[model samples]
Target: MYGDWSDAPRSLATLGYEPPIPGLIGSSQAMMEVYNLTRRVAGSNASVLLLGETGVGKEMIASAVHRLSQRAAGPFVKVNCGALSESLLESELFGHMRGAFTGAVSNRTGRFEAAHGGSIFLDEINSTSLHLQVKLLRVLQEREFERVGDTQTIRVDTRVVAASNRDLMDEVEAERFREDLYWRLNVVPIRIPPLRERREDIPELVAHFLNVYSETNERHVVHIQREAMEALQDHDWPGNVRELQNYVERAVVLAESDELTVDLLPPEIRSGTKRPPLGMSAQAFDLDTLTQEVVQQGLNEADPDAEDLHSRVVNRVEKELIAQVMQACSGVQTKAATRLGINRNTLHKKLKEYDLDS
Candidate 1:
């Protein structure tokens, strides 16, 4: 599922005055291609659609585009379309007039108006409702829009940089997104590669985060052991760079010496743990070769008509899953709870119940 970047152009590196993309810290071939495309499209007025999984740094790429463009001196505004309701999102993108609705105490300037003469990054644009998408299309096509409850038209020279974790073409096919809007935003599409797709960059990312967290936490953790680095490279980072960053920060804070050893890393990474597929059935998981012996022993001991057998198996699986996620998060309850998709208090109760609190 991953592609090689060995054939990517090296002209920029050969004649480098400074790194082409300053804030992005990857030298992989895939990243180099992204950098090349970003720099190529920066001078134009076209809309840029960034596609990638969450945590792949779309916002960072958007920022780089703005900084490298003619709008470098102008303001850069951002909004998460998926983070707000349709009504609120409408008001957020286009300002609402005073007395427009309940709680509209005073006149407000929305993100579009605030981003005038510069760029506005719409993160998770796939989440916008069709009604909002119509308005967004108008803004993109005409470069003008009126505030909510206002008949007066306002025009601005703002660039649009939209991003989505989903395939917008699929959204359009499903009638969830407007076709015109999709084409309008897809003028210069750039796909940000996930961490697993660019494993070669892991060591660089680790070193960078180590330096950052070390300085922030005033720690002497400057070096990472070879085994630790290998584990980091081997593990599948589902959360991408953000996950790696969190682990590094945790390791730095817990470091007993200047070196980051295997003991300081999360258990899953140190042990090269691989997660089961998201869609794998419980029965299939129980049949895994690694657990077959245990399951068979339990089956041999338990009565065929035991009423608690199912619940017992469920509890055992849940306990082991929680334990692994806990170790992966370095025992941070909040992080573990988030990874497990449970509330913190609920996780605390489970931890105590499973005798994993210690």
Candidate 2:
């Protein structure tokens, strides 16, 4: 291991920086397409726009791009445009000179200058105000910025990678975002599909998260029960991979054995009934088979008689189906009900009866 250590200087170039590997683990066709695109775009200097829902790991793609670029030795700066107030966001992006504002006792370098010869990632770029959009457009067009209080223009060379969960085209139509800036940033667009659309990748994602959080938590959850894995794959993950990771970490901490079980899941997922994949045979229905099932056994001790049995069974089935639909729709009740072939009012009433609405 130390064979070449004594002969070479530890310069940035010699540090042997390999590109940061993405944590994504999936062989599904959808993910393979994204991986191919990522690899192809990594070598270029062009600005990239990553479009995806929250918790879909847009920043990871940005980092991969920076690491694979020729400017791998330079810094990678990330800014969350949605988290800061407008004034603070402006100051953060462009920096400020001494005595520029209340807390400006000294001059400071902005993210752009700090990331000189490297890349800057702007997350939630759609959340920025219109005024800030104009300033940002100027920076992208001129590659220069002035300090908050200084007239001197500072020129910096930095690659930009912007990400947003919202539809920029819709924003343009609504006049909430600048069309010119949208065109400028969307030079090369990459869309990340949501978890539901790529259900086949759920198993791989679940396994990867389990292994990752297990190591972090110092637990020995080496395997997941087949039933548990099936439940994970069938349930609609509204929060996508982030939610799955959280559940896995929770299971690791609460699990009594090395295997993950349905009991370890949150109530919604644990109680959810799995739906068959598309084109699968529809199971034969038997009233007697379902009649023996208990409805909220502990909570509702008043069992339904023959007269109310139909209503109860219909309600129970509807509740379970709606819960899964809501998960797939990311808790958007209107969308969920529509997908379930029911009105919002009917869905809301059932949600309350099932004690799931809250």
Query: Global lDDT of each model?
Result: 0.86, 0.78
Q: Please list the residue runs of candidate 1 whose C-alpha ends up more than 4 Å from where it truly belongs after superposition.
A: 1-18, 276-358
Which candidate number has the best TM-score? 1
Give the lowest summed-lDDT range of ten residues in model 2. Answer: 277-286
For residues 1-358, what per-residue lDDT tens digits would candidate 2 score against the true structure?
A: 1143233455732554222245556666766667667766868877889998776768888887788788789989999999999988988999999999999999977888888999999999999999999989988899998978899999989989999988787677557899999999998888887677788888877777778778898888888998788778878676777777789889989988899998899877776764443222232334454434534442264454446765666676666666666666556676567667888898888888888876
Q: List the pairs of residues colliding in candidate 1.
A: none
Query: For model 1, how does the per-residue alpha-carbon lDDT over 1-358 read when each residue is reduced to its tens digit?
Result: 1233335568745664224477677788898889889988989999999999878889999998999899999999999999999999999999999999998998988899999989999999999999999999999999989999899999989999999987787677557889999999999999999888899999989988999999999997888899999999998887788888999999999998999999988888899987652222231333365356545555677789998887676676677778877765556677668767899899999999999988
How much does candidate 2 score in TM-score?
0.70
Error of 1 at 84 (Å): 0.9
What TM-score would candidate 1 get against the native?
0.74
